[model samples]
Target: MNEVLVSEKLVVRVPCAVIEYNGKVLAGQRSAALSFPLKWEFPGGKAEKNESDEDALYREIKEELDVDIEIIQKLPVTSKDQGWREIILVPFICRLKTLQITLTEHEQILWLGPEELSSLDWTEADLNVIENYYEYLSVKK
Candidate 1:
């Protein structure tokens, strides 16, 4: 895992995932109860202590989406200062190993192609990372 500290307000290190299936990438709509509520984002969560990025991502996906993923490639890590807290978001290219659609935190899920990527109302941090991802990752179709 890549670690960086800008201030004492560091909040968490999140391992975000980009799961590609068929020709589209997976996105989830966050529940309105959470921060940045109702915005779209790549599925992932905070990394636990002593866990590698890959391991944290795998565990997060299984817990959040109820699916197993195989990490194909790890992309760059982006850091953001959210006033009271700072976040280090790490993104990855991954393949889904299960087809089940399960969610405990998100309201819904969508599989969108590259052309439809920018049309969603994504969280600022997610959109920033998505921009970086689009430079190298393309929709399969």
Candidate 2:
């Protein structure tokens, strides 16, 4: 017989930003070296030690895309159970201060509308965020 273990863990607050321009949201394709490589996700990263969520968002956007963002709204937390590692993502609705995006951590990037989101192969963590955003948009309309 094989023994199995199950553990419950507290959720982490990882800040994410939804950058939209001309009615399309920005999504980056993770590098092949990453765990979920080639998957599309919003341009943001984990909150640094001793950094506020807002500060983390600003730094992440600037480092990853080389663009400044003005946070418009603090969106809800997007959670996902990844079996091994769980995640709690805080997504913010933001506007880009510049049009150019320089990919530093990602392999490629896409600016997609709501319809395009469903078609892309997103990471499990990102899929939850996408679904929640879709529901949010539906409710707003």
Candidate 3:
């Protein structure tokens, strides 16, 4: 007989910004130093214990991009299971407080139309976020 061990996976909550400017959305490419290097994702980070999602997003965007943003609305949440852990991405539609950006962690960033978003290699969770955002846009129009 074989023995099997099962345990609950860790869950991390991340608040992400879907920043838009002039009808284009912003995405950042993960630097080689990050876990998912080279994959594109929205700008944000994991929420620290006891921190609210909005506060976490503000702090993360400031730290990562060195810019401020006005969060407009919240989109449907997306999640992914990576075997070792599960990530729940809480996406917020936002606009930059300023046009200038200074990257701290990402290799680079791109501003792209919605149709062009699919061209980039996105993290699995972010793909779902894109789909939800698209649906929200379609319904809004």
Score each candidate by Cα lDDT.
0.88, 0.84, 0.96
Across 1-141, the per-residue lDDT of candidate 1 in tens digits comes to: 999876567689999998989979999999999989999999999999899878899989998999999898878788888887888899998898898968988999999996798999998888888887787665432
| Candidate closer to the true structure by TM-score (higher is better), 1 or 3 | 3
Q: Which stretches of candidate 2 lie over 4 Å from their true place?
A: 1-12
The digit string of per-residue lDDT tens for model 3 on 24-105 reads 9999999988888999999999999999999999999999999999999999999999998999999999999977899999
Better of 1 and 2 by lDDT: 1
What's the TM-score of each model vs. the native? 0.89, 0.86, 0.94
lDDT of 2 by residue, 39-62 (tens): 888878888789899999999999
Clashes of 1: 0
Which residue runs of candidate 3 sit more than 4 Å off their true CA positions? 1-7
